[model samples]
Target: MKLSYYLLCFFLVFTSCKKTKTDLTKITAKTIAIDSTITSAAAIDSMVAPYKEKLAAEMQEILSYTAKDLVKNDGDMQSSLGNLMADMTFDMANPIFKEITNKSIDFALFNYGGIRATIPKGNITKASAFKLMPFENELVVVELTGKKINELIHYFIKNKKAHPLSKSISLIINDNKYDLKIHGDTFDETKNYTVLTSDYLQSGGDKMVFFKDPVKLTKLDYKVRDAIIHYLKKVDTIQTTIDNRVILK
Candidate 1:
């Protein structure tokens, strides 16, 4: 009887110590939707009100004056607003670039999409600039070859939008062929040209593939909006007009 009890206890202990070989139960997560409406807390609003008011006041401060209305229109080869934006970028950025690299920017180019709003006649303020340029793009010089210039002309003809180009450049689409002149001189294939544009173009923005790999890339590290603001202030009155910068027959 004693031997039988010991054997039964050993059996019980062995069964208890044996590990189970069963598979783990799978877990599936289910989503429970919650209400998405958000309400502002008064404590947060009170903390932000003062800074917001100051920003609004600063944005409305007058920077300069406009002699006439500057509007951007599609299908037009040149627009007052486009010319002003491109010229101002060149004027403001080239000098600083020259000061650093001792080389001047041949011309400036910006996409029409970059112009977000229009400027009416009379007081030009920080608000107007902010509305015009909302992006914090930096000014850069892209040194492209003459072949690249031809590519740029072809690009213009293909798109046919009033992309901002400086006065120094004159592009005429003749017989579906590109006829372009830079700085009042015929393009020289053997020579290199310096173009002023935003780093956006440098990174292949707006399908500007030619600017992707330029001979040299120089950054002014100045925001384009800041350049426009400074240019507006430097020039007491803005008298930019639509010239025949781009003409097609």
Candidate 2:
């Protein structure tokens, strides 16, 4: 009787251990499968598509009404449209981003290609901003010296059609040459300056490699399209006036 009891206990313990191991193995396998599914390129793109579409629609609707009505004079539509784009870039960088990174960003540079179309006269909707910035690019901050900033200006001048800028910075370009100054002070080559711009620029798109050499870089989770949408929503009334911030000669 005693031997039988001992044998029974051993059998039960062995079975329980084996069952636990099997359960763990099953769970681990399931987890791996889930990870693999998420990492698939097609799956990721499909998931992102809906949001992109929604944003594009909203931006398009907004542009249809806003710039057309606001722009009065001839050729004013293009100029006003550019100003709005610049304002969107600046506003997004300032208050909206201050919470994420405590450091105050001195300037913002927005690429012109990102602006899709001129806003038409009337109501500006979320869809309009999306059309302007259709890409899924996110906001990225870079730190660089004044020398690099000058180089960026030169890059812009060289690639006039592709390079568009919205800056809190002040720069003078004469005869395809540039003199860059940021804020109220001249750029100090030895000192570092923090710049807020899109990830597209940081990634060497449109030949903007100046951001690549930053001592520190930070990417915000917020999308650039979303930022423009938020700004447009805040201003129920749209007005397009030339700030003369960008001069193309």
Candidate 3:
């Protein structure tokens, strides 16, 4: 009789503890106007003031100088700024890649849209680098087959936009056919070329699908903005030109 009483109590407790499902009944939304009506907290502002001042000083720190303005729209196939960007990226990221893999990056490429701002004919500061590459894109190396490299060339030609390419590559488009060279060597389909680019592009950003699914992919954990800053510090003056890196005939 005691055991039966205990079982009944246990059943009652279990039924009482059972959870019931809740259903969504109504939804509401409101638009808050953020005009001058909202006042910032004095404590919050005080806490952020020091950090803001420090960042401002660091951003304005001069790193290098440029004689002429470096703009991305200077050329149809290649721009002075684009060339500099590619070259500096290669120069900065190549050593890291080589140290890690004991292999050199064949070339560097970046989209035209990636050049967010141009360097004016004056001092180049840390702020300049940040402005040029505002995104937190890291440097990455992707070893692609020669076929994919060919497709990349075709894409550049089709777009006719100033896509930054390192000096290691020379592409001359003739009608539908093109002549390509890497590191002063004729194009070789049998060999794989390792390209240095931003992680964004490696993931096929800007419709550069050719960069996706490479033979090998390695992230150097280096930001493009940092690379630009480092390069600026190393060089006293920025020297770049629109060479025969890409040509259409």
For all the candidates, what are their Cα RMSDs to the real structure?
Answer: 4.0, 10.9, 5.3
Off by over 4 Å in 1: 1-40
Cα-based lDDT at residue 199, candidate 3: 92
What local distance difference test score does each model get?
0.88, 0.66, 0.94
Which of candidates 2 and 3 is the stronger one according to lDDT?
Answer: 3
- Among the numbered candidates, top TM-score falls to 3
TM-score of each: 0.82, 0.65, 0.86
Question: Which of 1 and 2 is ahead in TM-score?
Answer: 1
Give the range of the ten consecutive residues with the poorest summed lDDT in model 1. Answer: 32-41
The most accurate candidate by lDDT is 3
Task: Give stretches of model 3 more than 4 Å off.
Answer: 1-31
Q: Measured by C-alpha RMSD in angstroms, how accurate is candidate 1?
A: 4.0
Candidate 2: residue 166 Cα off by (Å):
3.0
lDDT of 2 at 199: 85
Tens digits of per-residue lDDT for model 3 on 145-180? Answer: 989988998898888899999999988889768999
